[model samples]
Target: MKRFLTLLIAVVIALSAMSTFAENAKTLKIGTDAEPIGFDPHTTPAHASIRIMHQMYETLVELDDDLNVIPELAVSWEQPDDLTYIFKLREGVKFHSGRELKAADVKYSFERILNPDLGALGSTPSYAGNIDKVEVIDDYTVKITLSKITAPFLASMSSIYCSIVDSEAVEANGDLLRADGGTGPYTLGEWVPDNRVTVNRFEDYWLDGYNFENIEFYVISDSSARMSALRTGEVDIIIGDSAMLSIAEAAPNVDVHKIRTRDYITICLNLNMPEFSDVRVRQAISLALDRQEIIDLACDGQAEVSGFAPASMGHWAVDVNEHPLYKQDIEKAKELMKEAGFENGFSVTCTVGLNDHIRNSGTVIQQQLAQIGIDVTVQNKENAQYVDDWKNHDFEMMICQNGAGSDPNRAVAFFFGTGANANIAEYSNARVDELCELGAGTTDVDKRREYYTEAINIILDECPNVTFASPYNYYYASSSLEGYSPTLNRPLDVRNVTKE
Candidate 1:
């Protein structure tokens, strides 16, 4: 009896120890869709790159769940004039390198990115392209002047591309990546190329909510692989699609999360191409596509068919059914094609990235355009090559996704503005350019939206591109994980996450 009693006590102690160990686990693992190109905040327009950089760096401002402008690094901001804006930094905030964040640092960061030599991606018309200069007023005060008054300037400040860097560290390492040059909740840790990047909690982080000791973002290119990782307990969370959602819903150990995103998909036509140069041809292609069917076939009915902007943007978005340009008419498309001197058909290649949904959309586009007497061959490329081709304007037709913004200026200005870097279609319109300028130069929300509205209608008429579907992003996590609230801007912030 004594031996049996001792054995029972030992078993209880072992169980308790195991339970404590499980509760104390502080590492949060995520399986992401793509590997980040680099940790340099200013270099890439890829969301994957920004998503990982967000863990270690922060912007001056951020949008809240309601898409309201809120302060992040800056305590507050004021616009003294139409072109000049001033910000007051948060006192006591320290960079991961142990130096206090100051106005000088902000000035240096902005100047470095703005330098044409640096070739920062955000230097293009879509992002910080409006900024004229940065001035350091004092240790805590910074002033920024814009060449022109623009609404996107405010939204641009919230982008990760404009993250303030530790000038001292950059001087030491020559770049921000692998240098721990930020004031955010985490510090850059190990980065194994094509595998994973780890961010450790900055012990001196200024905020209170971040609790995870380490957050690891593992790149699993294949969706099925990511789903398998989440299911088998290799990864705690995963960014997934409808197929993953269906599988995860049935998995007892997984918890599914749905984020209403402003991410919209578009099929861009190279206006430089001879066949796609005609407005009638472009408009016909737009009419040929059935946005609803694309959403259903590609997204598994987890998206809204839209025009230019997604329905998630509230009043800023145009309804597909109501918009004449978005209305599907196979007969109209054929007639337009005939009028454009392509009576029988034309063959064009549609390029796609590595993402499954995007690839599926390319395939669906190929099938839909066949009705309009157009033959499309879908070509898939590795993510890196795809980004390269996209940036160089190398494809005839490409299916891509863009992050949606609350402000109409950001939603349209970056992609539709003539000479804008994000304008993959190389679409040019004098009236649209004028509307973008008028919209951006104004502070009034309603008036700015009216400008965008007019510009959008003109863009539709011209048919430079087709903004089709806004799909809901689905993520799945381990049921035991807690405090994993994420937004469209920072989808994978696990700072407050804890193993329950």
Candidate 2:
């Protein structure tokens, strides 16, 4: 009887210890501008989608904090020739859907990305468009053949757009937009649209040290409100831009991190539009606005005026100061407007989202263009709707940010290259197209930079679209958080982060 009583007491004590440990486990809450644009990274070019998907999906390759290409699902890769590359998949990796990672899955992912019916409508398809075929050599080895020698092909695979999904689970689930079938550090727990997305850490995750048990992404559209949430301890972190940086800096118990990024803001113009189709009109519009002023007003002195290529691209870009067309000249702008027969000004719509910097930029640009007799109408849409409208080419002008790609070649190709998936501007130039092809094929660093410089110079003079400032990406977090660092290309990786 005494032995039984002692055993019961011991079991009770063990249970009490386990309960306390479980209660002590940390939960991370993050505030952002909006929830992911649906859940699939391939379908939407939204950063939110990529950020969340990074936790739920595993790319063959990934970028380290220094923007260096690192192995993820792929243990290593080799290129036997310019056109053919081979990859060896990691062994014993399991997907959230309980499927083992295989070469067939990689082959299917590449094939599905290129399939017209099942492919993404965004830049993912275009990134993999150069692929001739994906051949599965064995259960864990795959060979990818490209149509031509492409410089950014290997680096591009590191993107979230190239995230591998569990083929069997995705097929069974039927709806990929809501399904989570990936081999990432965490798996989707719940999603409430326009509100929050919650993900639980995957116990079977191959990599260790994913300290947090749960991560909740709350969508707070307003920058002030996001900052407020952080201040009140409702959320632990907020991903934002320069505008939110100041507020986070002023708040107590907060730490600010800024990543000097290659992301550039640009006003995309519909080249088919009668007004913008005229080069003089586009050039005049570019001349009217003060890019420096926009940077100061919208970005709170945390950014610089960006040129055709992002300033972060360094030596590869044409110096903005030396570019004649990039300089603002209000008189020249008015004269060009008069030359275009719009001396009395013409009204056009500038569509934007709820982002504070974008909205403020549009308003400031509207006021600036008025000086040159260009009547600008600001149209605010929800983030998803705004992106959809841009994709559908539904607006005369859309204020948008072009992301930094894995390489300079990909970055330049996304905006200036003809038939680029994100080329809402519908910009095309035979010379620029040839330059893009040349840049993609060139291996020498100097040769590649020269090719890009020529393309950037031509685009600057043509004014196909109005390039604005590149704002620094700032993330605010509670001081208690540790091991959190953001990369220029992919910000806010929480896999290794922990809280006190």
Q: Each candidate's root-mean-square deviation in Å?
A: 2.6, 4.3
Q: List where candidate 2 sits over 4 angstroms from the true fold.
A: 1-25, 119-126
Tell me the tens digit of each residue's lDDT in model 2 across 312-383.
766665567656666889999989989988889899999987467788889889999999887899998887
Against the correct fold, how does model 2 do in TM-score? Answer: 0.92
Among these predicted structures, which one has the highest lDDT? 1
lDDT of 1: 0.83
> What lDDT does each candidate get?
0.83, 0.80
Q: Show where candidate 1 strays beyond 4 Å.
A: 1-24, 124-126, 169-180
For 1-500, candidate 1 gives per-residue lDDT tens digits of 99999999999999999986764577788899987766778766676777778888888998887777799999899998988989999999999878888899989988888888877767755567878989999999999998988777777778887888888887888776556688888888898989998888898888887777888899998889999998898889898888787788899999988888888888889999988999989988888988889998999998888766778888888656677768889899999999999989889999998577789999888988999888999999888788889889999999988876776766777788887777889988899889988988887888987888898888878878887888888888988888877676667877667876
lDDT accuracy of residue 278 in candidate 2: 90
For candidate 2, the lDDT comes to: 0.80
Clashes of 2: 0
Q: Considering only N, C-alpha and C atoms within 3 Å, which residue pairs clash in candidate 1?
A: none
lDDT of 2 at 269: 88
